[model samples]
Target: MIRAKTILALLSLAAPAVAGDIPLAPPIDCTLGETCFIQNYVDRDPGPGAADFACGGLTYDGHKGTDFALPTEADMARGVSVLSVAPGTVKATRDGMPDIAMDRPGAPALDGRDCGNGVVVSHGEGWETQYCHLREGSVAVRKGMRVAKGTVLGQVGLSGRTEFPHVHLSVRRDGRVVDPFDPASGPATCGRAAAAPLWQNPLPYAPGGLVGAGFSTTVPGFDAVKAGLASPATLPAGAPALVLWAHAFGGRAGDAVAFEIDGPGGARIFEHRATLDRAQVRFFRAAGRRPPAGGWPDGAYRGTAQLMRGDEVLGQRTVTLRIGG
Candidate 1:
């Protein structure tokens, strides 16, 4: 069963991607030690005001930004360092924000400081690496102070918007963030930018679950094994409704990832096929399929996900569903 194989492949990566085995480099080198908990990063791109996004396995809306732990290395708390990814001047800094405490290992530390006390460095011409949730009052470089790449700008702290401690860092080029894991150098900038969306992915650091796998989002709280549907799951009337989020990863580009969402009556309410990105995507809304009347009647729905590697169903996931109003 090509489809069954594809489903299996996708499931294989799911646990590790969510739990971890995230890389540090081979990759790129950050000012901090080798990267760990690759699975737990949050998408805090282009610095402050940039749309925050989820980089973690789970989506914690607006809680975007990688929450690297303090040096698990000797002589340090779990997360306690903040450094520069590149050379620049302090463009902005903020401190004294409330901090949230975390008990989960590899989970973000501190509060308000998801990336720990935010710091934005101008690279001239609008290029920047927005670092955040830094140790309060520990900013070494103020606005206009020159810095070098990998410089220890400040200590990672569990301040504003954070639950654990670690450097919450990201790189921005021309007002948009580049995948820090695979950064390309160019002239920098310091332009006022629009509020960025909380990015669902930084893309540089992908969740393990995405690779060679079929994935989907349940209604806020879905039990993978249950054949349950969304409760009062509402979509804008006539608004193209696609699964909350469906992506395929590790499948090569040009390869297709297919999805079929069944409505009542065994009808294929949603079906889509698209080339997979390093991550896969099967957004059916673009296909003009809106949710059925009564917002998908209380019933059973099933989803079949297929991953094709050059016409091969390398993996797949068939999920059971139950919908109710």
Candidate 2:
């Protein structure tokens, strides 16, 4: 969230350290670019503007942690474990915050608890890692407990001042915030050579990507797509219309989303490309048409969606739906 820097400053305590770097493992148990995605990175810009470590617009001003985000609320409900990045002792933790998006009605006030349902681990040499927005009652470790790398701390959740479900990870060395992707904390030079990343296995940077795609009987609402309920495995032949939709993140103006649907026997049913007019942190688009006069033919239908920036495809997905199967 935009306020992460403030939260980290309030939570982190100074300590001494040696010179070696603390290599980190991914803190979440999921496939990157599939089950989960990097929604934001530590804000590298020191002024009022914001930029990710790659000098991209994936982060907001004052954001101090990396956000590993789930595509839908249903994914969060199924439980995704948050793991320890390295050997450490639990320094502190908080649990019991309800899993609710901050923008929802009746959501609880943060009340200085911006790092909801979280854990702070102390890796000696003044290195500490903090995991935030864990699900209610999912915290598995306690203060003073020794833990090895990959230890399960909790499940990701929308429990803090966040609009989506994700675990916010903040790394601090000797009480100063460190960008795990780039630990040398000065103004980020976009193309400058740098030291090795902190992750044990370096993560590739993605500027923007698709989150979800599917076929529906009608244009689906953004909320339904976000809840993982917009797409069904099958639609009756008599369904009023066939719609292909996609959800995406980090879209910039001038980008385009293309949608295509192919019926049985490879017959093209519809195709359309919608262009983004402005930058959006998250967005959804749909395209479709009413059924033919004969209702429909029973077989498999394939829907493909792609996010494009000129000739380069940022992300693409193909989904199949069966009719009268």
- Work out candidate 2's RMSD over C-alphas: 6.6
Clashing pairs in 2: none
RMSD of each: 15.5, 6.6
Error of 1 at 173 (Å): 2.7
Q: Write the per-residue lDDT of candidate 2 for residues 1-325, one digit (tens) a residue.
A: 1122311211212221225888889999999878998899999999999998778888999999999999999999999999999999999999999988889887899999998899999999889999999999999999999999999999999898988889999999889999987777786658885455788775756778789999888888888888886567888889999999999998999999999899999999999999999999889999999999988799989999988877677888889989887
- lDDT per model vs. reference: 0.44, 0.87
Model 1 lDDT, residue 114, Cα: 47
For model 1, residues 1-325, the per-residue Cα lDDT tens digits are 6443323222112111222122221112233222332323333343333222222222233333345543222212333446675567888877665444443245443444344467787766566777765666666667777877666677665565543344565656576545433232221112322222222222233232222112234322222211122222433333334453332323345566667878667877778776645532212111224565655565666667665667666545565555653
How displaced is residue 207 in candidate 1, in Å? 4.6
Best candidate (score: lDDT)? 2
Cα lDDT for residue 249, model 2?
90
